[model samples]
Target: MSNWKKVLSLGLVLLVVAVLAACGGNDEEANSEENNEQTEQESNTDVNEEEISIGQINWAENIAVTNMWKVILEEKGYNVKLSVLDMGTMMKALESGDLDVSLEVWLPVQDANYLEEYQDTVNFSDATWFDNAKVGLVVPEYVEEVDSIEDLNEHKDLFNGEIVGFDPGAGTMEVTEDLIEEYNLEFELLPSSEPAMLTQIGEAVANEEPIVAPLWTPHWIFSEYDLKFLEDPENIYGGVEKIHHATRTDFADEYPNVSEYFKNWKMDDEQIGELINYVENADEPIEGAREWVEENQDLIDEWVQE
Candidate 1:
């Protein structure tokens, strides 16, 4: 081969190599930009997730329902948190927009005042469980002498002329005072929380002693003990009640999907009673709720609408 021919071939090979190297560089640069774009898109999706904070009240149904929502929201890729609070504090939190949703709000019976107070600032879903809740004076079936509120004044000494009541802010507590006045019963209400009141009832029932206290339905206590609501012909105890969902006013606008899910949520008496029983018997409410969510995927599917 001639020297000029060899030199020409070498130059041709070097030019091809240089061109391929430049193309490879461009390809690497394009790949880098593509990765960066994908990362940004995923980060934006993460930001779109709504962080839902719930004001879970101290009650069996509240514990079961709120934690159940926590599990469902988390499953749907939402950020969820629960704050265990009393009815008063929970209402305040909802009014201030600090809490996102609460699945249990007994109304026209136990939480009417709270509802009326916060109706302007907070939002409530349609009645979730209707005609299940009942609130009034209750006693163990063993207490045969006191079948009605009117009989309470006659046997006031049996109960020490004291009526066990629920939380100070509890609607039942407020109504019970009216009961004392309407019945003209010479009894003082012992203000306490739900758990404390339950403990009192448990002790009295175990001892077969005559005891009178505020009680309600959709409560695990009814399943655990035999109790009856005293006759209130005057209807001072009101009528059959329902449970509603409560959320912050801005929640729906901020997260439409979640709001829709809540709006469609409903649980019947048997469903909630079983859930409350599970939670009360489980190691923790959240743990039980997680298991319930897993076992009840069909129900969840029905709830999470488009």
Candidate 2:
């Protein structure tokens, strides 16, 4: 072996090692950047993220109640974003930490599964936004000789043996099914969308026809149409309920000021019912909430102002 051959061989080996090292370093850097981007997206926190995110179920009470918070929060220098979703879906999102807050959780009416499962991950408001919320069968003013669920069995022919219901996933549907089994009532539970059910009831009431449906309080239906909840002698729908706010477990820690605003926030049945009435009967949600806020500035200022 010659000295030049040995030296050249050693230099070649060193050059190959340096090239591999450089390739490895590039790969690591690329991976780090990708991970950073992903984290940023999941967090989705704005650089100027002074806004508070609130989740809202598609019910009138939820929409109105949450919007009331939105108004209060905004007045206190916090921007607010209301994310509207279905009841069940909204609960799942709140449990998974996808949403920030929900102010429409009705006690004993909404599913208990999420409440039990995500108890550790969620926090409920100290004060209830509204009470007197209810769920049960309702009949129009024109429905004579039928004033109770028990009375329905005899008048099956009047309603075609079908009891109209709201969306399939609604808690009212669950209670209605239970009511049927408990009483052994002979009737079909028609699960339809909110709009569909409302349209049917509206038409029936307009023409003085008999109509039955799943109904709740603090809703605009009473204002839109003359209706009465059938006497639930069996009490299958549970008693009066209270609505409150639920947020991520870390919400208070992350946004203390916003949490304080939510904590101090409260409204009576009349205030919230009026808000719902505006959204449903008044045909204007955003405008209605805004007008309500403008008209009731004193009440709002009590919550946020000082």
Candidate 3:
């Protein structure tokens, strides 16, 4: 109603508006600082400085092979980091270019579909690790008259109508499923970790109890346990596979020297087996592998020599 009263009300409204704007600005600045801090932390955690990062899957052989590569890369004076992941996650990471390399791509078996889908994003090197690498239903030596996958159908009662399996996404597990379906075998494929499955095999072998499982070669278990692969008369399981090395498409160009060494990497069963055994049996994998590489420097040099 009065001029002074109206002017005072207008000033009060302006003051409240200014305070609200200041509070909003402060909140935005705080959010900006938090985002920048997170970005810095992520960059610090990533191995991004001209270093070679490899992706390894869940398998003992994969661990052995990955550590060997890590050793070779370190010896060449380049930083290398390995991220252990499952096959599915590993493939997605490789496709998205988060992971640089995968040394154990068991072909026509695990991740076969992944390779086909992500070939453009990745380049698979020639099989760096190759062997019979067979996957089939294996039994302890005491399974008397059973000799093959087909024969298991008749003796299902003995094995409690079950076949031990490794990780669910494992190549061996995939093949085991096919074998069961193809042969019309009445057995449940129980998925478990490789160590657990192998422990079961060991116990079964010790007691001479009948056991069937998805098994592979060039594995230390063969040497540690007395077992035999049940004959695959139906041939449902695929034939021998060559374990390969794979890298993100830009890997060679991005880290040429490290790529060169990896491209030239190759060895037979004897050489790999020695390292495998050393890593698997020894308490310290990195220390054990490092010692093996140092002792066999001549062989390593031969592979990485320019």
Candidate 4:
């Protein structure tokens, strides 16, 4: 217990305590610097983005809904691009990220094919409009000879032994073919484009001639012409279908505001039917959509949610 020994021990203890204190301070400083760096990195990653791309088909429902979104998204200070494509091609585009959002995806019926294939890769919004879709043997109301699908086969000669049909790829067309088989009808399901089919119907109706064509709901023809769907007793044509909006899975995340607006969009049979009529009467589809948007500013305002 000499003085020198005691001083040496005290000095060693002080040296150890000093080293521990320095290490703790260094650890604290290192943690603070790491956290600051992480915060800055995250802030740097948080960029404001505002552009979106859309894909749509040429069909009546698709055209109307797609153009409708195109007009509104533009009004919301977001750059929106709408590309016209076939159903299959549109699905492919959405999957590849070439497009951001798409319109008029009919579920459990018309768009069943596309949804089955791309539901994993794509995201679907809640039904914009519940499925009120109808596909049947549509005839001008003037043709009183055929009231139900059964009556059509009896007067096949009136319809010229031919049934006009829309694009071959459409879901209605597929079911129509099945309908023909299911009913065992002796008729030809002629495949033609929408415009061509419309032209035929217009010409036929102009002269009050009889024509049986495969048609659906929310179409301009329903509004402009007196048409009736042939009663389907066998339930071959199935039931009403809903229309939905679709996008790449990352769509809602990348463009949350736009996504919210999409989810907010809802329309009924009359509203959509009116839009289709407007488009059918207008010179061009986009102009028709623009006119509709202009006329329905209040509804659009409601759809653009905060």
- Each prediction's RMSD over C-alphas, in Å, is 4.1, 11.0, 13.0, 8.7
Residue by residue across 33-69, what tens digits does model 4's lDDT show?
9999989756533224545778866677778877777
**TM-score to true structure, per model:** 0.84, 0.77, 0.80, 0.78
| lDDT score, candidate 2, position 25 | 99
Expressed as tens digits, the lDDT of each residue in 1-306 for candidate 3 is 999999999999999999999999999999999999989766444224566778876566778878877887776566888897877677777778888888777777654766777788778786455755676778878777799777887888998999888788765677677767888889999998887988898888888788888877777888887788888776666677777778888777667656666666777777777888888877877777887888888877876776
Clash counts per candidate, in order, are 0, 0, 0, 2
Per-residue lDDT, model 3, residue 225, is 79
Q: Which candidate number would show the highest TM-score if scored against the true structure? A: 1
Number of the top lDDT candidate: 1
196-287 per-residue lDDT for model 1 (tens digits): 88998999999999889988787899988999989997888788888788888988877777777776777778878888877888898888
lDDT by candidate, in order shown: 0.82, 0.76, 0.77, 0.80
lDDT of 3: 0.77
| TM value for model 3 | 0.80
Can you give the lDDT of residue 119 in candidate 2? 71
Q: What is the lDDT of residue 255 in candidate 1?
A: 76
Error of 2 at 86 (Å): 1.1
